[model samples]
Target: MGRKSWFWGILLCGLIIGSAASGKASDFRGNRWGGSMKQVAQQERAELEFRDDQSLFYRTRVAGLNCYLIYQFDRNQLYQAGYIIPPRNRNLNGCFQDYQKLLRYLVADYGEPQENQALWSDNALRDQPEKYGMAVSLGHLARQAIWYTPGTVIRLRLWGENRQINLGAGFFRRTQEETHPHSKTVFFGI
Candidate 1:
């Protein structure tokens, strides 16, 4: 081939490879974000904890807490994965400690969150930081942290309702709707 043809050949090949790599759905573990549900089932590190029409939960441990690993699917294609520290027979103090431990783990792996919130609905216990957990259990406070990655958004939430504590992390994809003028996607900021 002529010198000009040789350079064009290499450039075309490079463009083809780059486009294929960028076509991947999203960044996550177990399998590609658009992979089959069976692909994730094969990689489970623990027993199945729960399941429904569109989600799977596996019992696992993270950050020293017994938790449930979550796998969510759309039309049987894996789209999201996360963890939830399950409910247990523990006090408010213990519950909040678990949240803190899990929070630190995410920060270590993904850096500081873009937004961190500890919202209070009542101030009766506001001055008592030591009893913040109690405030949470009483439905007076809720906490959440958010971090954004190249193609994913990570959220860590700790809240209470009906005197019950809840904690979990969710990984969701940020779609091209971010730039597509006609897309239906909406990103509600923290």
Candidate 2:
């Protein structure tokens, strides 16, 4: 009985390990759901900083023709972030007041389409600054606000992961008065 139990335990452990071993590497992409439908979650942006002087930046992304929402906040030279997605996008907008409900929630806010190139931008001097750190992948998202002296530099990132492929997207934000440099980086999977 002891030997049998040990064998069973070993089998279970092997099965678990085998399943995990099939997952994609950090930069590797893969197919999912037997090719019926593939999905990738958003990723987080890489760590970045500002230059000697720069300010106020913005960026955006869409989910393969779908929109994503982002919320940004500033406090005493510090920056914060929030996210929202609308119910309509979640297939839950069935009620007569769905629009109103969505407006209230902003859980899945529809923003712009996904960025095709490695970088994106809203300000002229910087479009996903090349010197700043940035990383975004499917299924997750991250942002950084660098407070250099009295100015503010904001970095935004979004990523998602599914059985199929990995995806990453991001942008940056800075204020006009702020004088901090910015950096940029890219992910390859998505």
Candidate 3:
């Protein structure tokens, strides 16, 4: 190929790849925002359980982790979705491993999170035997990692206790409204 033709070909390929990657930001396992509960159920081939007027639940596996999903709707339009690790796999060490794996998968798909933090206070309760036992049993409550896209906010949280571990991810709509001022505003005479 001529030099000019090769340059144009490379540019076109780059654009196509960029667009495909960008399109994934708003999708959850091929289900995009505004998709209906019926659509998701059909896609997953799972039985959908209705929790209330605004929520639906189902079980599925994502990235090899068995999880239960809760889909929340506003006016019948899906506005939020959550993937939760099942209670059966709640060992503290196992939970941490699974959480790390999930985090890596999310980073690969969505790029780095906008805010990432991990917090633990093992020494805070060491002096108090009563609190220390509970604290240890409950493991540590890790800070969530959040990511923002144009119209969506994605959050990842992993936490557990001796008996139950919980790892979850939530995708929510990014509200467009501005926050109102704390104090009321007064208008001058026109």
Best by lDDT: 1
Per-residue lDDT of candidate 2, residues 1-190 (tens digit): 4533432232232110000111223211222211111121123331221111211111332332222222112221212221212112221112213223322222233232222123333233234433222222222222221122112222222222331111122222223223212111111111
Could you tell which candidate, 2 or 3, scores higher by lDDT?
3
Candidate 3 clash figure, as a count: 0
Q: Give me the displacement of residue 148 in model 3, in angstroms.
A: 1.2
Query: How many clashes in each candidate?
Result: 0, 58, 0
Q: What is every candidate's alpha-carbon RMSD to the true fold? A: 16.1, 21.8, 17.5
lDDT on C-alpha atoms for all candidate structures: 0.63, 0.22, 0.54
Pairs that collide, model 1: none
Clashing pairs in 3: none
Q: Which ranking of candidates, highest lDDT first?
A: 1, 3, 2
Over 4 Å off in model 3, which ranges? 1-26, 39-52, 121-140, 161-163, 176-190
Q: Cα lDDT for residue 170, model 3?
A: 67
lDDT of the structure predicted as candidate 3 = 0.54
- Per-residue CA lDDT of model 1 for 1-190, tens digit only, reads 6533432232232110000012234355445666677777786667885566666667778888887676666678665566666568986778767878988997987789888888899999999988888898887988888777766667777777668677777665555224323223211111
User: 122 in model 1: Cα distance from truth in Å?
Assistant: 1.7
